[model samples]
Target: MVTRDSAWPGGVPCWVDLGVDDLDRARAFYGELLGWEAPPGSPETGGYSICLKNGRAVAGIGPKQGPPDVPPAWTTYLSVADADETARKISAAGGKLLVEPGDVMDAGRLAIAADPGGAVFGIWQSRAHTGIGLANEPGALCWNENMSRDYEANLAFYRSVFGYDYDDMSANGFRYSVFKVDGNPAGGIGELGADFPADIPPHWMAYFAVADTDAAVAKVTELGGGVLRTPWDTPYGRMAILGDSQGAVFAVIAMPAGG
Candidate 1:
């Protein structure tokens, strides 16, 4: 299992959170599904719930922001050395800042931005609070990836902003690459080909590790969530896409040993 007590390296996906219409329901849903414990958030931070697994920070759930038409969604955050500098790079690289760089109390500073293709993600400069405490274990974050409609433009944008290097994995008509940070796999980028629904916007996907993909999918249904895709086996794991009761999407994977 991967664990960290401090900030992650720059460009690594260090955190993830869900913005939901009903914070209590989201907290309960994930608590039961992933064996997490979510306590009420401090009022100073707008009651943002932090989900914990094995007493370690795992993810967050907070009241939805933006217009009512904007559905609840999950966001992946990359660790950065300087959020203000990263926000500048985002604008220079043709991306838009949804939330300008600002401090979250004394916990940290952050900014939310969207790529040219409109995939939204966050950049975090850690302070008193580091990112997630545990990962690559059941009930914790396992992976993150960007699915982009304007594949090449988004790729260029990320490389320009974060200096990401990628290993091309495109094959059999699929265009995909694993982005690396400091010579290690950090995340991935994949083309949302013609087959994907046009209404689906480009976005970052966060995956949580599960011990049993099939069982977890069943639990999601039992908890009133819907399955976007049935579990299927890949070389790395058995995985499925799912939406929470409020329609926030995420994936769950049961990795092969040591994967």
Candidate 2:
């Protein structure tokens, strides 16, 4: 029953591309820390390098571009069935339309969008590219979270677009508003405060899995990524935030033993 209803091409995530301020520096830093092998790109692939873990595509690397408004950061692209229709629902749901749906030729449709709180993300309608090939793998994206001021709008927009459901239920003193994709447990959506710790913006924060939180936090400093959070516990696992060598912000979660 391979129906088009549940169809998400390339994969659900295909991969995440980091708009790095310095590709050479990021290559060196992440290379040492994550043990990724990034080979040179060709004309067909543009300048983006495909990062491999144990010789498989884990993520991608590309130089940052755009106006002064562009910050060096990682943007998450979620797989959807129809990107144009999803973009329409974004505006109708009170979210901002950042980029209109455009064709990646035969690759599929894509559009950039922001939630009610102005956190930017991309919607990928995969014709050829599905999503990320590897998730929950070391150095790859483990999870993505939307920290927002308006949880209702955030939940509504995503629910309309990807047909996701929110738990909105708390457990063990930690609020776990889990995001589900087509009824499967996905990641999360958390509340954002104005005076939040460490100057975090209302944005989608990606989590990369690491073997050790303490060691990874230490190596973040050694590799030139700045730490925002020390190791902390949750129902999921231990996690921390750090800026990559190129100054793009992201986080890493160290899974607990026997979980």
Best by lDDT: 1
lDDT of 2 by residue, 121-201 (tens): 888886665556566766677777878777677777777656676777655544448876656666787776445664667
Q: Tell how far residue 178 is off in model 2, in angstroms.
A: 0.3
| Model 2, TM vs. native | 0.87
Regions of candidate 2 where Cα sits further than 4 Å from its true position? 1-14, 43-46, 171-176, 257-259
Candidate 2 displacement at residue 233 in angstroms = 2.1
Which stretches of candidate 1 lie above 4 Å from their native place?
none
Name the TM-score of candidate 1. Answer: 0.98
State the lDDT at 121 in candidate 2: 84
Residue 225 CA displacement from its true place in model 2, Å: 1.7
Give the alpha carbon lDDT tens digit for every residue of 115-233 in model 1. 99889999999998899999999999999999988889988998999999999999878899999999999999999998888887899999999999999999999999999999999
Worst 10 residues of 2 by lDDT: 1-10
Count of backbone collisions in candidate 2: 12
lDDT of each: 0.93, 0.73
Error of 1 at 125 (Å): 0.5
